[model samples]
Target chain A: GAGVSQSPSNKVTEKGKDVELRCDPISGHTALYWYRQSLGQGLEFLIYFQGNSAPDKSGLPSDRFSAERTGGSVSTLTIQRTQQEDSAVYLCASSPGINYGYTFGSGTRLTVV
Target chain B: SQELEQSPQSLIVQEGKNLTINCTSSKTLYGLYWYKQKYGEGLIFLMMLQKGGEEKSHEKITAKLDEKKQQSSLHITASQPSHAGIYLCGAVGSNYKLTFGKGTLLTVNP
Candidate 1:
């Protein structure tokens, strides 16, 4: 079985630019999540989508961060006007639902200079 | 404020030794998940605990959830060099999001 997949394994961009990271969740997985892992830091929750609904968007760091899941399959996390602080590994994960284990993608490492 | 706190920040052990890592939460946890990540890679789910006093084991790894509902521990028996990586504990609340600990960097020496 194919696991979750993310695009552009690594991205380097200048400050003030925008980057879009894409995630393709496993088939039939209705719950998708995006998280950021800073160097030597924990995984920070960004946004989550469950069947076209995001009940919790509170974890998004700021207005510059936004994510959308289309057709309950693919998800895109966009970071607007990127800063050095946003230079981290962006991770995507999908689960069957509550109590199910989540399968994560290899992640897109974003380096802002 | 961080909802979950993992201790020891790091650990180093010889191959075939035993090691334990702990995760404590400021709030009650509805579910606890353990994951391992190799350098420059995504996390791989190890185990999940949903109820207090729950215990689950996978191969050489075992996990226990306290009845108090705020703590969990992951124990590795007969550690191998392949276990060298970052161990993270994630706690889920009523919300859908998962709050992760800072992770324990484990270095298993062969």
Candidate 2:
């Protein structure tokens, strides 16, 4: 891909329902990152994947949030029992590695009703 | 807790005016990167500085990292309306995560 791509550019789900967001990073990118952006706010780091190793999930807000990168390419972020506070733009970015500039996706705007 | 803090949460300036935004970190930063985001849009990478006392410029924008490595500044000269957007600074640490500031929203009126 020419740039990072995310699925379901917009999602509207009722509270208590689970939702999944997907990210396909730039080809050959070794580092993938997930961030959440609240309305009129800056991005909040959610998780990061470096190559095929275990992901850095320390940024996840809670246990209900989990992410996995398969084959070090496509990744999925799943949020269970979504809360109104969870409504925000979910962004994905990738870089050759963390030391370089990151290319971000268009982002998925998730809304919990 | 927010590890990074940016000043001037919002600024309104006339076209052709110059402006500067500052970012300070509580911990020493290994790297600092700046990004811009338009309303309802993804972030666009602007610049990155790795070493202290390093400076880089692109067109009308120039960024500098202090020798102390605790602060950074983004200066836009002869700014244009196109430069209107939210500016954010991120600091990378040993944990390999880029902690971002709340951002400074700039509006350049023509």
Candidate 3:
């Protein structure tokens, strides 16, 4: 793709239901990142993937949150047992490397009721 | 923990006016990036600064990294209505994690 692409631009789900967000990074991008943005808040780092290496999950808020990158191109973020606090815009970004600026996707606005 | 603090949580300026936003870090930064986000839109990368005392300009926006490498400032020259958005500053820490500051919302009134 020309830029990072995210699926389900908006999602509204009941609390306790699981939700999945997908990201298709720019072609040939070796670095991918996931972030969450709550209302009036800054971007919160969630996870990072670099090539075929083990993802840096240090930023994941809890065990319920996990992500995986398949074939080093597309990634999926799954939030199990969603909580109201999980309602936010989930953003995905990709870069050539950690030293470069990232190109972000439009993001998926998740709302838990 | 490394953190970035942005000043002037919000600003309202008239079109054609100039404004500056600052981002300070608790730890030395190896790289600083500036991004803008309009309402309901994705972030738009503005500039990236790596070296201390480095400055870069694009169109009407300019960004500078302090000599100490712990601070950065973004300056907008002749602001326009199209520039109304939230400006965020992000920095890469020694751990290789990118942290961002709560953005400064800029509203340029025409």
Candidate 4:
């Protein structure tokens, strides 16, 4: 893991409590992504795995937002009952397929007060 | 549903002056990404245009991809101040998911 690796970079939950964000990609890099950046908004496409397929949640913006990618390389993004617009910053990217080009991490700044 | 449109949303150059950022897409673009952010963190992979008039550079930043691929452009020749920040444009959807464009805030007033 020389790149993509996210964790609790900064979090201050409160609203409803329930926040778990983690992503460790770049190992074999099969493709995994989850994004959200509210403050001024822009990158918002939360959910997409590529190895075993079946994960393109369309862009989960509801259902309390959820994500998972186990045996393929570690990934989790759960935002159960957090509101306050759900704070911001929460990105994680990894790709080594589909043409290749993606390796982002250093995110997870959710602050719901 | 791959829509990306980024234009002069913010810019204020001066140090060596030379800027140009634009990313337009309404479809067509199996791959086209260029990102740079330093405001809150995350994202820093610049360059990736798929075929059709593709172009890439990574020293003074230079990207272009238009020929019906919807459009893409990001040029920063002499600009300094570390080239400011916030500049995004990603498009590669339909299954691989990757749709962005709402960034373009570079200020290098040195």
Prediction 4 global C-alpha lDDT = 0.88
Q: What's candidate 3's DockQ score? A: 0.82
- RMSD for each model, in Å, please? 1.4, 1.3, 1.1, 13.6
For each prediction, how big is the interface RMSD? Answer: 0.8, 1.1, 0.9, 9.1
| Candidate 1 lDDT | 0.92
* Alpha-carbon TM-score of each model against the true structure: 0.95, 0.96, 0.97, 0.34
Local accuracy of candidate 1 as per-residue lDDT tens digits, B3-35: 889988999999999999999999888899999
What DockQ does each prediction reach against the true complex?
0.85, 0.80, 0.82, 0.31
Worst 10 residues of 3 chain A by lDDT: A50-59
lDDT by residue for model 4 (A10-62), tens: 99989988889989998998888888898887888878888745467877889
Model 1 residue A76 CA deviation (Å) reads 0.5
Cα miss at A77, model 4 (Å)?
A: 7.7
For model 2, how does the per-residue alpha-carbon lDDT over A1-113 read when each residue is reduced to its tens digit? 99999999999999999999999999999989999999976788999889756456788999889998999899999999999999999999998976799888989999999
Go through the candidates in order and give each one's C-alpha lDDT. Answer: 0.92, 0.91, 0.93, 0.88
Worst 10 residues of 1 chain B by lDDT: B90-99
lDDT of each residue in A19-81, candidate 1, tens digit only: 999999999998898999999788988888997778889889999998888898999999999
Best by TM-score: 3
Q: What docking grade applies to model 4?
A: acceptable
Instruction: Itemize residue pairs with steric clashes in candidate 3.
Output: none
- Stretches of candidate 1 off by over 4 Å are none
